[model samples]
Target: MKNLKIDREKVLLGVAGPVLALVVAFLLTALVLIVSGYNPFEPFELMFGAIGEQDVQVLIINQTGVYYLAALAVAIGFRMNLFNIGVDGQYRLAAMLSAVVGAHFSPPGFLHIVLIVVTAMLVGSFWAGIAGVLKVTRGVNEVVSTIMLNYIATSLIAWLTLKDQFGYQAEGSNDLTTGEISKSGWFPGIHVSDLAGDIYGFIFVAAGVGVVYWYVLTRTRFGFDLRASGASESAAAASGVDSKRMVLTAMLASGAVAGLAGMPVLLGQTHTYSQSFPTGVGFTGITIALLGRNSPVGIAFAALLMAFIEKSASQLSYATPPYPPEIADIMKGLIVLSVVISYELVRRYGLKRQQSRVGRELAAQAAKNRKEVSA
Candidate 1:
């Protein structure tokens, strides 16, 4: 269990900023609703009533797992101060190729799952490695490269799916899917009842990933060098840390984790990558990573909160007379905006505070020495 007591700096930076931003975002959303002529409280009331239902709870848990993986993937890059926007492309490509590989193979049950996972990680790492290589060798910016990769991945998947060899066939097939994966490949689900969807057993996989992320980033020497490079490339180089290798490794790690972002949907539920497969989760991971301040525990809570908001707000449209569903989108946007702004302001304040404290300490020390000389 975490210690109940938090230091002032942690409270200010981690807790205060997020809480203030959330409060402001909600206030702004309420204003938006009022100006647009709707009863804001009604939607919240309706959403709160539905949020506790068995099915809704299951959805929140399922989505939280996916989002958590995505956030962890993004956080890996973030710790190195690298922006990896290609998670969308990485996961989608990984899921597709992994699915294809899984369909063709007939290994032992556990080994089959292992092979599929390894395929995904390899594909994701290779794809992300392109950006890493470009950055190291050609001085290209990762943000630009990753964005371009996302577009490339989209088009590439389209072409591959249309080819007969990868399992594209009639347009009216059960789904825009490959041949069904055998039961051996499927990750068993935790059964509940008909009313609530079974929790994906792959949730344990997500939990394991989170633990590894925290351990590796906090405990390992490579983690120290990676963070040192992020802080100052010049300082790291002076200390014999290879900034280029760190960049490449961080990107590869980011992409490898990104590969797992879609596995729950594939191995746990869908069993294939198709046109209807979940998309845009990679992008959502970026948002969650920022909201969670790139901390593992924070990301977990943020993921669940985001999933909960989406799950609950969706019910507004089904209300007796109906409330606008777009309200949820507005709330999300406002919260992100507010949080970004708040963090910047708090960071500046913290810097100024440190400067003031240092100045006062030096001045006091000098005066004390002068007094001693007079004595």
Candidate 2:
């Protein structure tokens, strides 16, 4: 009974923080909408309605896979106390190069897809490894180095994608692309319905990544060392873990995952990297990682929630009073802020409860001892 009670409490405490944060975020967002003279409730109603639409559901699922991969990448870095802000640049560069390779290859069977994915992972790891090297060797902060690397990567991509370079301009299109991959290189997706469109096949790969992430973190020795180092570098070092090596490993792993973030869209939909390839997803991954508390399961839910919000928000512009689509951005920001505050509060409360329980147990034992001695 006691064990069961403790387990129940643990479960409740685990869920309370996120639930409290979300509730507070919604209330605060409502306040903002009221102050702006718009019906916040109406926007939420519309968004909820969108959840029932098949097409929107398909979009949310597709986007969730992308967001999940990105968040996992961020979570890997978080495990080792590294901030890999350059995931944006790393994935973009990886996708660009991988697209180039995919465009040139006409390998038979699944080899083409495998080649593109491996190329992306290698490129991303290499790009992110630079920051790790600087941090370990020169004591440069990963944050600063990664940020600088992002700028460099952006410039490099822009130059490489120029029409005269690896990129080419199609006859009728204004956008520059790495040239379309042959049909053999394209990823096959699951067709839902005519109205719903095809679901990204890479979703399975994302799910596999999450499973691997969970297993590695909770059941592996390397994961133990990585977590220990993140918790306290000196303590971890005393325990025989090499903190520098862990940092580099974590960054590389994170980058490798980030490299896959763009693969779903590129192979399943775009079939090429263009001047208009998605950006800022790496930054969004940071937000999702924090929201998910760095857990694989938690991250999955957070990614789904985020994707749902983004997809549903697109309908606001077509509403009767037409709320601005930016409202979703505001709500996301508020949720993130609320999550930080609520989690801290929950942590403190849980600590106090445990301390109180321990004190009560100690006092009860003391009282029993005195009674026995008196008898």
* RMSD list, candidates in order: 2.6, 1.2
The CA lDDT of each predicted structure is: 0.87, 0.93
Runs of candidate 1 exceeding 4 Å displacement: 1-6, 168-174
Using lDDT as the measure, the top candidate is: 2
Whole-model lDDT, candidate 2? Answer: 0.93
lDDT of 2 by residue, 302-329 (tens): 9999899999998899888799999999
- Residue-level lDDT for 284 in candidate 1: 82
Question: Over the stretch 250-285, how does candidate 1's per-residue lDDT look in tens digits?
Answer: 999999999999899899898888888889889889
TM-scores for all candidates?
0.94, 0.97
Name the top TM-score candidate: 2
